[model samples]
Target: MNIELWWPKLTPSTRVGLLENNGDAVPPQVVAEVTRAGGSAAIDSDSEESDYYLSDEDVEWIETVTNEEEPTEGLILSKVRRT
Candidate 1:
């Protein structure tokens, strides 16, 4: 499944922690906290629409956040595939 996370802004430390251990799925508590912080996570599908959207840069930012230790900015977009 494709999971997209949209947030106004997140601290660098928080971004790393979010993807450190969790794979494929993010913890519910994290999701809840993000929601409280004006963020949202939703399934990426052809039919269903999400309240939040990510731009090309936003998508690339997520890739950098997940793959590198360097800090990133803007929204978070993570795509997880289940076997």
Candidate 2:
């Protein structure tokens, strides 16, 4: 599955700058869980879609506080997959 992770703030996190800030990274445990469930995880700085697909549990976690209730029309987000 294609997952889009929204980058709320633009900072520098990874060596390649894939993530803006290390503080905004998704939890490792979450990645492990997704992998264990036969899925892959990747981080993205930009995504175009508004809707996403993931397990119900993960979905619940995804729709958490972005600190900004305002909509992000063109901001980038992370992406995960179920391999």
Candidate 3:
């Protein structure tokens, strides 16, 4: 599977260097997901990222990565305990 990266949106004060500079470019969840799925991802920092994003599947995986305290698949149900 070919994965495309959507760089994170730049904040108002984020403009610090040349527009083409990949150094300050934000890494999106696409990079993580592609890696997690056992595939390689290509970064296209020049491309535009939309304000609206994150499909259902994308959201779930992003959460898993941010919350490093838990594993991805078992994360959700692991928190729910029987009363």
Candidate 4:
């Protein structure tokens, strides 16, 4: 997907991490996904503040290499016990 078409779909609330001085540019699909999830995204130097951060190369991987069908299927989940 072209970044120009999907870039506007990103909401201000979506947080995206971007590395400075990296040659790669963020794909619009990533931004669209973040916004669709109702989260905030931005390219910033500080990773501590952002909910999710990724390097320029990482971003490219996410957009091109990452599996879109099962985005988070590999994660291990645990049930929380109530006090």
Per-candidate TM-scores read 0.38, 0.25, 0.25, 0.24
Instruction: Report backbone clashes per prediction.
Output: 0, 11, 0, 10
Worst 10-residue stretch by lDDT in candidate 2?
A: 7-16
State the local distance difference test value for candidate 2: 0.36
Off by over 4 Å in 4: 1-26, 45-83
> lDDT of all the models against the reference?
0.47, 0.36, 0.34, 0.38
* Best candidate according to TM-score: 1
Relative to the true structure, candidate 1 reaches a TM of 0.38
Residue range with the least summed lDDT across 10 consecutive positions in model 1 = 74-83
Task: Give the higher-TM-score candidate: 1 or 3.
Answer: 1
Range of the 10 consecutive residues with the lowest summed lDDT in candidate 4: 74-83
Candidate 1 lDDT by residue in tens digits, 1-83: 12233443454444565545433344565656556666655554553644333334534555565565343533344433222
Task: Please rank every candidate by lDDT, starting with the best.
Answer: 1, 4, 2, 3
Candidate 1: Cα lDDT at 51 = 32
After superposition, candidate 2 runs with Cα above 4 Å error: 1-25, 45-83
Q: What lDDT does candidate 1 reach at residue 61?
A: 53
Q: Which candidate is the best by lDDT?
A: 1
| Candidate 4, 1-83: lDDT as tens digits | 43323334544332233222123434566545845644334666554543333344335434532223322333222211222
Assess the local accuracy of residue 69 in candidate 1 as a C-alpha lDDT between 0 and 100: 38
Q: Pairing residues by index, what is the TM-score of model 4? A: 0.24
